[model samples]
Target: MAGRFTGKRALVTGGGRGIGRAIVERLAAEDAAVVVADVDLAHARSAAEALRDKGFTVEARTLDVGDPASFASFDERLDVLVANAGIQTFAPASELTVADWDRVLDVNARGTLLTLQLAARCLREGGAAVTVASIQALLPNALSANYAASKAAVLSLTKSFAAELAPRGIRVNAVAPGRIDTALSDFGSEQVGRITGQDAAEALQRRLSTNPLGRIGRPDEVAAAVAFLASDDASYITGECVNVCGGDVMA
Candidate 1:
Protein backbone atom coordinates (compact mmCIF):
# COMPACT_ATOMS: atom_id res chain seq x y z
CA MET A 1 0.00 0.00 0.00
CA ALA A 2 1.21 3.47 -0.75
CA GLY A 3 1.90 5.41 2.43
CA ARG A 4 0.01 8.62 3.10
CA PHE A 5 3.07 10.76 2.41
CA THR A 6 4.25 9.07 -0.78
CA GLY A 7 5.61 11.54 -3.38
CA LYS A 8 6.04 14.29 -0.81
CA ARG A 9 9.14 16.24 0.16
CA ALA A 10 9.63 16.78 3.90
CA LEU A 11 12.05 18.91 5.86
CA VAL A 12 12.49 17.88 9.49
CA THR A 13 14.44 19.94 11.96
CA GLY A 14 16.30 18.29 14.85
CA GLY A 15 16.31 15.12 12.82
CA GLY A 16 19.49 13.82 14.42
CA ARG A 17 17.81 11.94 17.27
CA GLY A 18 14.65 10.98 19.12
CA ILE A 19 11.21 12.05 17.86
CA GLY A 20 12.73 14.17 15.12
CA ARG A 21 14.74 11.24 13.78
CA ALA A 22 11.73 8.98 14.04
CA ILE A 23 9.65 11.42 11.98
CA VAL A 24 12.38 11.65 9.38
CA GLU A 25 12.56 7.89 9.09
CA ARG A 26 8.81 7.50 8.91
CA LEU A 27 8.48 10.11 6.20
CA ALA A 28 11.11 8.32 4.12
CA ALA A 29 9.42 4.98 4.72
CA GLU A 30 6.28 6.54 3.29
CA ASP A 31 8.30 7.38 0.14
CA ALA A 32 8.87 11.05 0.78
CA ALA A 33 12.24 12.53 -0.04
CA VAL A 34 13.49 13.83 3.30
CA VAL A 35 15.96 16.39 4.54
CA VAL A 36 17.36 15.56 7.99
CA ALA A 37 18.20 19.02 9.26
CA ASP A 38 19.82 19.35 12.65
CA VAL A 39 22.28 21.40 14.66
CA ASP A 40 24.45 18.28 14.99
CA LEU A 41 25.76 17.93 11.46
CA ALA A 42 27.41 14.59 12.17
CA HIS A 43 24.25 13.04 13.53
CA ALA A 44 22.22 14.49 10.69
CA ARG A 45 24.57 13.07 8.05
CA SER A 46 24.69 9.72 9.79
CA ALA A 47 20.92 9.56 9.92
CA ALA A 48 20.59 10.46 6.27
CA GLU A 49 23.27 7.96 5.30
CA ALA A 50 21.69 5.21 7.34
CA LEU A 51 18.36 5.82 5.67
CA ARG A 52 20.03 5.90 2.27
CA ASP A 53 21.71 2.61 3.03
CA LYS A 54 18.26 1.24 3.79
CA GLY A 55 17.14 2.38 0.32
CA PHE A 56 15.21 5.41 1.47
CA THR A 57 15.60 8.77 -0.27
CA VAL A 58 17.10 11.09 2.30
CA GLU A 59 19.56 13.98 2.65
CA ALA A 60 21.16 15.76 5.58
CA ARG A 61 21.85 19.41 6.33
CA THR A 62 23.05 21.50 9.25
CA LEU A 63 20.48 23.95 10.64
CA ASP A 64 20.39 26.03 13.76
CA VAL A 65 16.66 26.35 14.24
CA GLY A 66 17.17 29.53 16.23
CA ASP A 67 18.99 31.24 13.39
CA PRO A 68 16.85 32.46 10.50
CA ALA A 69 19.86 32.59 8.17
CA SER A 70 20.60 28.92 8.78
CA PHE A 71 17.05 27.99 7.84
CA ALA A 72 16.93 30.31 4.82
CA SER A 73 20.16 28.96 3.36
CA PHE A 74 18.49 25.60 2.68
CA ASP A 75 15.98 27.24 0.29
CA GLU A 76 14.40 24.06 -0.93
CA ARG A 77 10.77 23.68 -1.90
CA LEU A 78 9.03 21.42 0.61
CA ASP A 79 5.66 19.75 0.94
CA VAL A 80 5.86 19.28 4.68
CA LEU A 81 7.88 21.08 7.32
CA VAL A 82 8.32 19.58 10.80
CA ALA A 83 9.60 22.13 13.27
CA ASN A 84 10.72 19.61 15.84
CA ALA A 85 13.90 21.30 17.07
CA GLY A 86 13.87 22.30 20.75
CA ILE A 87 15.78 22.40 24.07
CA GLN A 88 14.92 22.28 27.76
CA THR A 89 16.07 23.83 31.02
CA PHE A 90 15.35 22.86 34.64
CA ALA A 91 15.14 25.35 37.49
CA PRO A 92 12.61 27.19 39.57
CA ALA A 93 11.29 30.29 37.80
CA SER A 94 13.29 32.44 40.18
CA GLU A 95 16.42 30.35 39.99
CA LEU A 96 16.71 30.11 36.22
CA THR A 97 19.15 32.54 34.64
CA VAL A 98 17.95 34.86 31.89
CA ALA A 99 20.34 33.12 29.49
CA ASP A 100 18.75 29.76 30.19
CA TRP A 101 15.27 31.11 29.53
CA ASP A 102 16.41 32.82 26.34
CA ARG A 103 18.09 29.66 25.06
CA VAL A 104 14.95 27.60 25.51
CA LEU A 105 12.72 30.23 23.90
CA ASP A 106 15.13 30.76 21.03
CA VAL A 107 15.20 27.10 20.16
CA ASN A 108 11.56 26.29 20.82
CA ALA A 109 9.35 29.29 20.08
CA ARG A 110 11.50 31.41 17.77
CA GLY A 111 12.69 28.34 15.94
CA THR A 112 9.13 27.27 15.31
CA LEU A 113 8.25 30.69 13.90
CA LEU A 114 11.25 30.64 11.58
CA THR A 115 10.40 27.17 10.34
CA LEU A 116 6.81 28.14 9.61
CA GLN A 117 7.78 31.39 7.92
CA LEU A 118 10.40 29.74 5.76
CA ALA A 119 8.05 26.94 4.81
CA ALA A 120 5.36 29.43 3.87
CA ARG A 121 7.82 31.19 1.64
CA CYS A 122 9.04 28.08 -0.19
CA LEU A 123 6.31 25.43 -0.05
CA ARG A 124 3.76 25.03 -2.83
CA GLU A 125 0.06 25.35 -2.35
CA GLY A 126 -1.48 22.61 -0.15
CA GLY A 127 1.74 22.29 1.80
CA ALA A 128 1.58 21.70 5.57
CA ALA A 129 3.63 22.56 8.66
CA VAL A 130 3.88 20.74 11.98
CA THR A 131 5.25 22.34 15.11
CA VAL A 132 6.28 20.15 18.03
CA ALA A 133 4.94 21.50 21.27
CA SER A 134 4.84 19.79 24.70
CA ILE A 135 2.26 18.57 27.21
CA GLN A 136 3.84 20.85 29.77
CA ALA A 137 2.31 23.69 27.80
CA LEU A 138 -1.07 22.71 29.14
CA LEU A 139 0.05 21.11 32.37
CA PRO A 140 2.16 23.45 34.39
CA ASN A 141 5.53 22.32 35.78
CA ALA A 142 7.40 24.82 37.89
CA LEU A 143 10.80 23.42 37.03
CA SER A 144 10.10 23.60 33.32
CA ALA A 145 8.58 27.06 33.16
CA ASN A 146 10.67 28.19 30.23
CA TYR A 147 9.99 25.09 28.15
CA ALA A 148 6.33 25.10 29.07
CA ALA A 149 5.95 28.75 28.14
CA SER A 150 7.58 28.26 24.77
CA LYS A 151 5.39 25.29 23.96
CA ALA A 152 2.31 27.26 24.92
CA ALA A 153 3.40 29.86 22.46
CA VAL A 154 3.74 27.18 19.79
CA LEU A 155 0.09 26.22 20.14
CA SER A 156 -0.95 29.82 19.70
CA LEU A 157 1.36 30.22 16.76
CA THR A 158 -0.05 27.14 15.08
CA LYS A 159 -3.53 28.58 15.29
CA SER A 160 -2.39 31.94 14.03
CA PHE A 161 -0.56 30.47 11.07
CA ALA A 162 -3.41 28.22 10.17
CA ALA A 163 -5.81 31.15 10.00
CA GLU A 164 -3.49 33.09 7.73
CA LEU A 165 -2.30 30.19 5.59
CA ALA A 166 -5.67 28.56 5.02
CA PRO A 167 -6.37 31.05 2.26
CA ARG A 168 -3.29 29.74 0.47
CA GLY A 169 -4.39 26.12 0.79
CA ILE A 170 -1.78 25.47 3.47
CA ARG A 171 -2.48 23.80 6.80
CA VAL A 172 -0.68 24.38 10.06
CA ASN A 173 -0.86 22.16 13.13
CA ALA A 174 1.07 21.16 16.23
CA VAL A 175 1.87 18.05 18.28
CA ALA A 176 2.15 18.27 22.04
CA PRO A 177 3.89 15.22 23.40
CA GLY A 178 3.94 13.95 26.93
CA ARG A 179 6.69 12.02 28.68
CA ILE A 180 8.42 10.62 25.65
CA ASP A 181 11.69 8.79 26.29
CA THR A 182 14.17 10.67 24.10
CA ALA A 183 17.65 12.15 24.46
CA LEU A 184 16.03 15.49 25.19
CA SER A 185 14.12 13.95 28.09
CA ASP A 186 17.26 12.23 29.33
CA PHE A 187 19.06 15.54 29.34
CA GLY A 188 16.10 17.20 31.02
CA SER A 189 16.10 14.58 33.75
CA GLU A 190 19.80 15.04 34.35
CA GLN A 191 19.31 18.78 34.74
CA VAL A 192 16.38 18.20 37.05
CA GLY A 193 18.46 15.87 39.18
CA ARG A 194 21.29 18.32 39.46
CA ILE A 195 18.97 21.15 40.37
CA THR A 196 16.77 19.29 42.86
CA GLY A 197 19.18 16.72 44.31
CA GLN A 198 17.01 13.91 43.03
CA ASP A 199 18.15 10.98 40.94
CA ALA A 200 17.25 11.16 37.29
CA ALA A 201 15.30 7.93 37.57
CA GLU A 202 13.29 9.32 40.46
CA ALA A 203 12.44 12.45 38.59
CA LEU A 204 11.37 10.51 35.53
CA GLN A 205 9.32 8.12 37.59
CA ARG A 206 7.47 10.99 39.18
CA ARG A 207 6.80 12.60 35.84
CA LEU A 208 5.84 9.40 34.03
CA SER A 209 3.44 8.41 36.76
CA THR A 210 1.33 11.41 35.80
CA ASN A 211 0.54 9.88 32.43
CA PRO A 212 -2.52 7.64 32.36
CA LEU A 213 -0.80 5.21 30.00
CA GLY A 214 1.47 4.06 32.85
CA ARG A 215 4.46 4.27 30.50
CA ILE A 216 6.34 6.98 28.72
CA GLY A 217 5.57 7.34 25.00
CA ARG A 218 8.00 6.28 22.29
CA PRO A 219 9.43 8.61 19.64
CA ASP A 220 7.82 6.54 16.89
CA GLU A 221 4.43 7.07 18.53
CA VAL A 222 4.87 10.83 18.39
CA ALA A 223 6.23 10.60 14.87
CA ALA A 224 3.08 8.79 13.77
CA ALA A 225 0.99 11.67 15.02
CA VAL A 226 3.16 14.23 13.26
CA ALA A 227 3.08 12.24 10.02
CA PHE A 228 -0.69 12.00 10.22
CA LEU A 229 -1.01 15.73 10.62
CA ALA A 230 1.27 16.30 7.64
CA SER A 231 -0.65 13.91 5.39
CA ASP A 232 -3.76 14.44 3.29
CA ASP A 233 -5.55 12.13 5.73
CA ALA A 234 -5.61 15.19 7.93
CA SER A 235 -6.54 17.59 5.18
CA TYR A 236 -9.27 19.21 7.26
CA ILE A 237 -7.16 19.37 10.39
CA THR A 238 -5.58 22.74 10.95
CA GLY A 239 -4.83 25.12 13.82
CA GLU A 240 -5.04 22.20 16.22
CA CYS A 241 -2.62 20.83 18.76
CA VAL A 242 -2.97 17.08 18.82
CA ASN A 243 -1.78 15.93 22.22
CA VAL A 244 0.25 12.73 22.10
CA CYS A 245 0.59 12.75 25.85
CA GLY A 246 -0.87 9.35 26.82
CA GLY A 247 -3.89 11.03 28.36
CA ASP A 248 -1.75 13.02 30.73
CA VAL A 249 -3.96 16.05 30.09
CA MET A 250 -7.40 16.89 28.73
CA ALA A 251 -9.44 20.03 28.09
Candidate 2:
Protein backbone atom coordinates (compact mmCIF):
# COMPACT_ATOMS: atom_id res chain seq x y z
CA MET A 1 0.00 0.00 0.00
CA ALA A 2 1.11 3.51 -0.69
CA GLY A 3 1.85 5.93 2.12
CA ARG A 4 -0.25 9.00 2.88
CA PHE A 5 2.25 11.32 1.20
CA THR A 6 3.46 8.95 -1.51
CA GLY A 7 3.10 11.44 -4.33
CA LYS A 8 3.40 14.66 -2.37
CA ARG A 9 6.33 17.05 -2.11
CA ALA A 10 6.98 18.71 1.26
CA LEU A 11 9.42 21.33 2.52
CA VAL A 12 10.24 22.00 6.17
CA THR A 13 12.27 25.02 7.21
CA GLY A 14 14.73 24.50 10.09
CA GLY A 15 14.54 20.83 9.19
CA GLY A 16 18.13 20.28 10.26
CA ARG A 17 17.31 19.44 13.87
CA GLY A 18 14.79 19.33 16.68
CA ILE A 19 11.07 19.71 15.94
CA GLY A 20 11.68 20.63 12.33
CA ARG A 21 13.81 17.54 11.78
CA ALA A 22 11.12 15.38 13.37
CA ILE A 23 8.51 16.79 11.00
CA VAL A 24 10.75 16.09 8.02
CA GLU A 25 11.36 12.54 9.17
CA ARG A 26 7.70 11.87 9.78
CA LEU A 27 6.64 13.18 6.39
CA ALA A 28 9.42 11.24 4.67
CA ALA A 29 8.35 8.08 6.49
CA GLU A 30 4.96 8.59 4.88
CA ASP A 31 6.74 8.64 1.49
CA ALA A 32 6.73 12.36 0.77
CA ALA A 33 9.58 13.80 -1.27
CA VAL A 34 10.95 15.92 1.57
CA VAL A 35 13.17 18.98 1.38
CA VAL A 36 15.18 19.72 4.52
CA ALA A 37 15.57 23.49 4.39
CA ASP A 38 17.73 25.21 7.00
CA VAL A 39 20.09 28.13 7.42
CA ASP A 40 22.69 25.69 8.75
CA LEU A 41 23.79 23.79 5.68
CA ALA A 42 25.71 21.23 7.71
CA HIS A 43 22.68 20.18 9.72
CA ALA A 44 20.42 20.16 6.68
CA ARG A 45 22.82 18.02 4.68
CA SER A 46 23.35 15.63 7.54
CA ALA A 47 19.61 15.20 8.10
CA ALA A 48 18.88 14.71 4.41
CA GLU A 49 21.70 12.18 4.09
CA ALA A 50 20.52 10.19 7.11
CA LEU A 51 16.97 10.01 5.77
CA ARG A 52 18.22 9.11 2.29
CA ASP A 53 20.22 6.29 3.81
CA LYS A 54 16.97 4.93 5.15
CA GLY A 55 15.55 4.91 1.60
CA PHE A 56 13.56 8.13 1.94
CA THR A 57 13.36 10.59 -0.91
CA VAL A 58 14.89 13.67 0.73
CA GLU A 59 17.05 16.63 -0.22
CA ALA A 60 18.73 19.57 1.49
CA ARG A 61 18.37 23.28 0.70
CA THR A 62 19.60 26.48 2.30
CA LEU A 63 16.83 28.83 3.41
CA ASP A 64 16.92 31.99 5.43
CA VAL A 65 13.25 32.42 6.03
CA GLY A 66 13.62 36.10 6.93
CA ASP A 67 15.06 36.86 3.49
CA PRO A 68 12.70 37.05 0.52
CA ALA A 69 15.55 36.54 -1.91
CA SER A 70 16.13 33.11 -0.42
CA PHE A 71 12.65 32.06 -1.46
CA ALA A 72 13.36 33.01 -5.06
CA SER A 73 15.70 30.07 -5.42
CA PHE A 74 13.12 27.63 -4.01
CA ASP A 75 11.36 26.82 -7.25
CA GLU A 76 9.59 23.61 -6.36
CA ARG A 77 5.82 23.34 -6.65
CA LEU A 78 5.16 22.29 -3.09
CA ASP A 79 2.30 20.26 -1.68
CA VAL A 80 3.12 20.91 1.98
CA LEU A 81 5.04 23.58 3.87
CA VAL A 82 6.15 23.38 7.49
CA ALA A 83 7.28 26.79 8.74
CA ASN A 84 9.22 25.75 11.84
CA ALA A 85 12.30 27.95 11.86
CA GLY A 86 12.37 30.16 14.98
CA ILE A 87 14.67 31.74 17.57
CA GLN A 88 14.00 32.55 21.21
CA THR A 89 15.57 34.88 23.76
CA PHE A 90 14.76 35.27 27.41
CA ALA A 91 15.02 38.61 29.17
CA PRO A 92 12.94 40.65 31.56
CA ALA A 93 10.90 43.43 30.03
CA SER A 94 13.22 46.05 31.48
CA GLU A 95 16.37 44.32 30.26
CA LEU A 96 15.41 43.19 26.78
CA THR A 97 17.49 44.80 24.06
CA VAL A 98 16.10 46.06 20.76
CA ALA A 99 18.46 43.80 18.87
CA ASP A 100 17.21 40.74 20.75
CA TRP A 101 13.63 41.70 20.06
CA ASP A 102 14.32 42.21 16.38
CA ARG A 103 16.21 38.98 16.03
CA VAL A 104 13.46 36.96 17.69
CA LEU A 105 10.65 38.59 15.76
CA ASP A 106 12.56 38.56 12.50
CA VAL A 107 12.96 34.80 12.55
CA ASN A 108 9.78 33.78 14.38
CA ALA A 109 7.27 36.21 12.88
CA ARG A 110 8.59 37.71 9.65
CA GLY A 111 10.21 34.45 8.76
CA THR A 112 6.94 32.62 9.14
CA LEU A 113 5.21 35.21 6.97
CA LEU A 114 7.82 34.84 4.24
CA THR A 115 7.48 31.08 4.32
CA LEU A 116 3.71 31.26 4.02
CA GLN A 117 3.88 33.76 1.19
CA LEU A 118 6.27 31.55 -0.75
CA ALA A 119 4.16 28.53 -0.01
CA ALA A 120 1.06 30.29 -1.27
CA ARG A 121 2.80 31.16 -4.49
CA CYS A 122 4.16 27.69 -5.16
CA LEU A 123 1.70 25.34 -3.49
CA ARG A 124 -0.80 23.58 -5.72
CA GLU A 125 -4.48 23.75 -4.93
CA GLY A 126 -5.45 21.58 -1.95
CA GLY A 127 -2.02 22.11 -0.43
CA ALA A 128 -1.45 22.65 3.30
CA ALA A 129 0.84 24.80 5.45
CA VAL A 130 1.56 24.09 9.08
CA THR A 131 3.38 26.62 11.24
CA VAL A 132 5.14 25.80 14.48
CA ALA A 133 3.99 28.20 17.15
CA SER A 134 4.48 28.08 20.94
CA ILE A 135 2.32 27.58 24.00
CA GLN A 136 3.89 30.75 25.39
CA ALA A 137 1.60 32.62 23.00
CA LEU A 138 -1.24 31.66 25.30
CA LEU A 139 0.51 31.18 28.64
CA PRO A 140 2.58 34.36 28.36
CA ASN A 141 5.86 34.00 30.24
CA ALA A 142 7.31 37.15 31.69
CA LEU A 143 10.81 36.08 30.72
CA SER A 144 9.80 35.35 27.12
CA ALA A 145 7.81 38.41 26.23
CA ASN A 146 9.37 38.80 22.79
CA TYR A 147 9.09 35.15 21.89
CA ALA A 148 5.50 35.01 23.11
CA ALA A 149 4.46 38.10 21.21
CA SER A 150 6.04 36.84 17.98
CA LYS A 151 4.29 33.49 18.29
CA ALA A 152 0.99 35.18 19.05
CA ALA A 153 1.44 36.97 15.76
CA VAL A 154 2.04 33.63 14.09
CA LEU A 155 -1.20 32.24 15.51
CA SER A 156 -3.09 35.26 14.21
CA LEU A 157 -1.42 34.97 10.82
CA THR A 158 -2.43 31.35 10.56
CA LYS A 159 -6.10 32.23 10.99
CA SER A 160 -5.97 35.09 8.53
CA PHE A 161 -4.17 32.98 5.93
CA ALA A 162 -6.59 30.11 6.41
CA ALA A 163 -9.53 32.41 5.67
CA GLU A 164 -7.87 34.06 2.71
CA LEU A 165 -6.63 30.82 1.18
CA ALA A 166 -9.78 28.77 1.68
CA PRO A 167 -11.11 29.91 -1.70
CA ARG A 168 -7.90 28.66 -3.30
CA GLY A 169 -8.30 25.21 -1.74
CA ILE A 170 -5.32 25.67 0.61
CA ARG A 171 -5.42 25.03 4.35
CA VAL A 172 -3.38 26.88 6.97
CA ASN A 173 -2.99 25.82 10.58
CA ALA A 174 -0.53 26.00 13.50
CA VAL A 175 0.87 23.72 16.14
CA ALA A 176 1.70 25.24 19.55
CA PRO A 177 4.22 23.04 21.30
CA GLY A 178 5.06 23.36 24.99
CA ARG A 179 8.25 22.39 26.83
CA ILE A 180 9.58 20.20 24.09
CA ASP A 181 12.97 18.54 24.58
CA THR A 182 15.07 20.22 21.89
CA ALA A 183 18.15 22.40 21.64
CA LEU A 184 15.89 25.42 21.74
CA SER A 185 14.39 24.19 24.97
CA ASP A 186 17.87 23.54 26.31
CA PHE A 187 18.76 27.13 25.63
CA GLY A 188 15.64 28.22 27.42
CA SER A 189 16.55 25.96 30.31
CA GLU A 190 20.00 27.49 30.55
CA GLN A 191 18.46 30.92 30.56
CA VAL A 192 16.18 29.88 33.33
CA GLY A 193 19.19 28.66 35.27
CA ARG A 194 20.88 32.01 34.89
CA ILE A 195 17.75 33.78 36.05
CA THR A 196 17.01 31.50 38.97
CA GLY A 197 20.55 30.51 40.05
CA GLN A 198 19.73 26.84 39.49
CA ASP A 199 21.47 24.21 37.42
CA ALA A 200 20.17 23.81 33.88
CA ALA A 201 18.79 20.37 34.53
CA GLU A 202 17.11 21.53 37.71
CA ALA A 203 15.62 24.50 35.94
CA LEU A 204 14.29 22.26 33.22
CA GLN A 205 12.87 19.89 35.77
CA ARG A 206 11.07 22.68 37.54
CA ARG A 207 9.57 23.86 34.28
CA LEU A 208 8.47 20.34 33.38
CA SER A 209 6.85 19.93 36.79
CA THR A 210 4.26 22.48 35.79
CA ASN A 211 3.09 20.38 32.87
CA PRO A 212 0.14 18.14 33.60
CA LEU A 213 2.01 15.21 32.12
CA GLY A 214 4.88 15.85 34.55
CA ARG A 215 7.50 15.70 31.81
CA ILE A 216 8.86 17.61 28.87
CA GLY A 217 7.48 16.70 25.43
CA ARG A 218 9.37 15.19 22.52
CA PRO A 219 9.88 16.73 19.08
CA ASP A 220 8.23 13.76 17.39
CA GLU A 221 5.07 14.32 19.43
CA VAL A 222 4.68 17.78 17.99
CA ALA A 223 5.54 16.41 14.53
CA ALA A 224 2.64 13.99 14.76
CA ALA A 225 0.24 16.89 15.16
CA VAL A 226 1.79 18.69 12.19
CA ALA A 227 1.55 15.54 10.08
CA PHE A 228 -2.14 15.24 10.87
CA LEU A 229 -2.78 18.81 9.81
CA ALA A 230 -0.79 18.34 6.61
CA SER A 231 -2.36 15.05 5.61
CA ASP A 232 -5.85 14.32 4.26
CA ASP A 233 -6.73 13.31 7.81
CA ALA A 234 -7.25 17.00 8.54
CA SER A 235 -8.82 17.90 5.18
CA TYR A 236 -11.66 19.74 6.87
CA ILE A 237 -9.54 21.28 9.61
CA THR A 238 -8.25 24.78 8.97
CA GLY A 239 -7.69 28.04 10.85
CA GLU A 240 -7.09 26.13 14.05
CA CYS A 241 -4.10 26.06 16.43
CA VAL A 242 -3.58 22.62 17.83
CA ASN A 243 -1.76 22.67 21.19
CA VAL A 244 0.71 19.86 21.70
CA CYS A 245 1.57 20.95 25.21
CA GLY A 246 0.78 17.88 27.29
CA GLY A 247 -2.40 19.61 28.47
CA ASP A 248 -0.53 22.78 29.45
CA VAL A 249 -2.92 25.00 27.48
CA MET A 250 -6.36 23.46 27.93
CA ALA A 251 -8.30 26.45 26.66
Top of the candidates by TM-score: 2
List where candidate 1 sits over 4 angstroms from the true fold. Answer: none
Expressed as tens digits, the lDDT of each residue in 6-57 for candidate 2 is 8999999999999999999999999999999999999999999999999999
For model 1, residues 135-233, the per-residue Cα lDDT tens digits are 889877888899999999889889999998999999999999988889888888898898889999987888777768889899999999998999999
lDDT agreement of model 2 with the native: 0.92
Query: Which ranges of candidate 2 are over 4 A from the true structure?
Result: none
The local distance difference test score of each candidate is: 0.90, 0.92
TM-score of 2: 0.97
